[model samples]
Target: MEASSEQPQSVSVHLARLVIFSAVVLGLIVGTLEVTLEYKKLRTTLFEHSEQVAKAFEDIAARAAANRDRSLAEEVATGLLEFKSIASVEVSDETGTVLAWKECGQVEAFGSWLPFEIPSAQHTILLELSTPSSGGEAKGYLKVTASSAQATQIWASQLGMVLISVLFGTALLAGTLLFITHLYVSRPMLRLAEAFRRLDVSDPKNSPLPDPEMFRFREFREIAENGVRLMRDIKRNSEVRDLTANELYRSQKRLQDFAEISSDWFWESDRDGGITYISPSFTKTLNKKTGEVYGRTIAQTTAEPVNTPKWHKLGEIQRQRRQFRDFRYDMAIQPGEVKTVSINGRPFYDEDGTFIGYRGTGADVTNERLIAEARNEALQRAEQASRAKSEFLATMSHEFRTPLNAIIGFSSLLSMPELLKAGVDRVTEYSTAINDSGQHMLALVNDILDISAIEAGKRVLTLEEVEIDGLLSHSLSQIESQAGAKSISLIVEQNAQVGTMVSDERSVRQILLNLLSNAVKFTPSGGEIRVTVDEIGKDIVFRVADNGIGIPSDRLPTIAEPFSHSAIHPHVAKEGTGLGLSIVRSLAVLLDGGFTIESEVGTGTTVTVRLPKNGSGASGEVQTA
Candidate 1:
């Protein structure tokens, strides 16, 4: 069987052992001192007794010595030996002759039987014999040797009794002290310890301590009171600590939720600006894992070069430990795909004010960037439209007033009696001038209405099979007189293989007429115009060429837009409503065809129109000029 481990001694047991040991040590010291003092007293008493015996026998011994009386000396020595302290005695004469000797054999034997040895005491006495008249004369010497055997034996008996008494007293005192300490100190302290052991710090109010009054000693009572106060303080501090921890946990959870749910990603970096943490939203925003981004600096993630102004500014801000916001940059998240990112960050420091690094939120702002660009573009378009409207109003005013002025002047002339009676030819000329101005005004109004209808999506097409040659010939014939007025040459090239095509007859004819008219208007006198019609693939292609003051290259992009002429040459813009090409373009689009124009300053222009053979149902491709 395994031996039980040694149990620890309680305070009471330890105190009892200490008291017993102290009492035993003190008893031993007192006993030894008493025994030693008794021994010395016994020796002194024996010496004193020997001196008395010597004095009493002095006269007798001297007389014996002078007379040489052996019986007398023997009597003195034997008498001295009668005393228990005197173990042996000898009487000697002046001549050195021993007169008598006596010794106690029993005393010697007794000393030898004793547990310890005691040395015999020795004394010498002088003997004198003399008359009263004559001074006493020395007669003999008396030698006395005393044995301490009896005294030592007596001392031993007393010592044994004294030690017994001391032992009994020491044991009794130790027992009494042990009881007192256990009751007054040890037991009370043990109770206090047990109370502490059972105490619940978590609920200090309900966990009572041993009452201070339970301890008999003032010091112990005070200790109990202090323990109560300490536990109370501990409970209060613990409650506060728990509350703070709970609040901190909730705050952290809220921040975590915000980071998880937000569209933006949160990031943290070390002091060297290397990425330490990136939230899960980083993957959602950049289409890359957070792990891949870790250990990389912000500059490494950007498409821009590290030495770019944006990075330089960011570096400067970080170096100065400042906050920055709305810092936008481009990041190539994937091959050939760059996203715009905006970040707001601030430098963080530890409690000791050592720079930690940066923490911030970043959002993929590519969509926002695109939207902003589109908004700016729309604003520019609106401004251009407003300017064009003003120009159109100005051009229209001039065009209208010119015709109105002619009509008013001619009508006023007709109203005058001198003009009315002038002649039929004059009247006819005035009337024709008014008619021509009205017709010009009517044509301008028609162009305006047609353009408005097209823009409003109200224009419709009536598709049919059409003769390409007939259409071209009719279109060229309408502009022939205008070309003749300028003495310009009009050339037509028609492919016989381009016999017919299915399309909106009116739109096709109108498209060709507008092209021819624009050519005539732009061509100088004696310049040439060429018209070509051919079938290309599944479409009928029409080309109108002019050797005239061609359109400016810068204005070509918007040349087919209505009222765009003001941006071109002012002289050419004023001569017409600037809706001819616009109408042609709109009609071509409505019929699912394409129109393109190529022009150069002083080098002339070429305008091409592609009409699908199958009309609005067929796809027509537009070639860029």
Candidate 2:
């Protein structure tokens, strides 16, 4: 396309030619004018010089002619001829008789400035010589002829210089214009044309239009920018048109496929409710003959001794000349398996509005109906999951912020002058509160990190043989202060026979501490919290029971899920982060263990952890009940 728009002359050539031609014409005009003016001035100078010479020798020539001294008169003429510009000199007596005459070499017919020979008469000047100094009478006439060679040579030299300068300047100007046009205009235009030609039509997105910034000329830049915009618009339009055409084609193809398939079929009936035409695909679906069903009512062809309200309703519509759509019915095709079909129909009318017949389509929609139901169920589940996550984030925010607020508030109070003067006990109390808040925050952070690590498969258990008795002792000791602060009783019981189990000590300790702390927090003052360790078969069992607020039986199923606090115990307001139970469950899995929780609303709650006696089996085997 760009190639076809090429002009015979490029812009640079056109500009250069125009400017050079103008310069030549101007040079010629100026040179001609200068030569003409100089020639006139030369003629006037020659004539004036000739007249002065003739007058100077007037007295001498008159004296010589009066005495008839021909030698003396000839002497003066010869002296005048000494100047090369004087081509001829003639001196005659007062009677007009020629006395002395001299003539030198003839001037050339053609000189530098003049294209043809100049007339010798034009350069010749004749002056009268008044003989006596005081007398006006002429004794002789002096005719002097000055050759124009000197003047012509001078004019030719000047004109040659002027023409040389003009030619040089014109060439320079043309060269400079060509250079600038090629650099800033022509080159960029060619590059842009090439870019447009090479643009990939298959992937318009990847093919970018030429950048206007790449050009030096303002007009070219503007043109490039507008061209790019136009190309982009064309690309977008092309994409949209292609997409629409593709969609249209797909729709048509789908319709054609549907028309050819036996899954969905078309049928027509008369106003009398008798089957007039049944599509071949419809007969194939029923595994029956089209001839068998022709002219028969729908109830007569495939009717069975079963509930078919759709048929009855369709018959009523036919009698009333009304339209019915997507009326579902069950057809017990031969051998007792029912195939549910949904049909749609509209009553047709003639020109005069008389009822003609009914025409519609039907499909075996049993599988489609089942699929739609499954999708609805999946959507409902997704919505529920989304709601659960939202609630979890809200609850977790409160859980995290509570400790942060406490830590900040108490730390600020600890800096008070009054508290400093109040003495050590108050300082210690504030310090303890800060410490507890800090620990709570740390636990929350750890739980989140741990769960994330487990989910990402980065959580590895460093297993070792850990004594059950020592673990129990350490867990109980850590939470004893917490229990004491609440005035809750702590009980520890363990079986000596249940010795040691290979497991991650840190994880087990975390599990124990979390459960014991929960017990301490929830158990009212004076209530008992027991930590019992025993052996059950190949697993070592640890149970932490507290006579605190317990969970209802209905909430047990989802209790182990992260942030399932609200779902677990909707009415009870729990203080601890909901992550504790979830973390414990995850850790139990990581260390090859089983975890369970049994609770009654007002009675108490007991959480049990069972780990494999030896960590020989694969870790991350968690069973919860």
TM-score of 2: 0.40
Number of backbone clashes in candidate 2: 1
Question: How do the residues 233-345 of candidate 1 rate in per-residue lDDT, one tens digit apiece?
Answer: 88788788889999999998988899889999899999998999988888977898787778998888888878877788889998888999999989887789899999889
Model 2 residue 412 CA deviation (Å) reads 3.6
Model 2 weakest lDDT span, ten residues long: 616-625
User: Candidate 2: which pairs clash?
Assistant: 589-620
Runs of candidate 1 with Cα error greater than 4 angstroms are: 1-9, 102-135, 147-150, 202-206, 241-249, 265-278, 293-300, 306-323, 346-360, 384-625
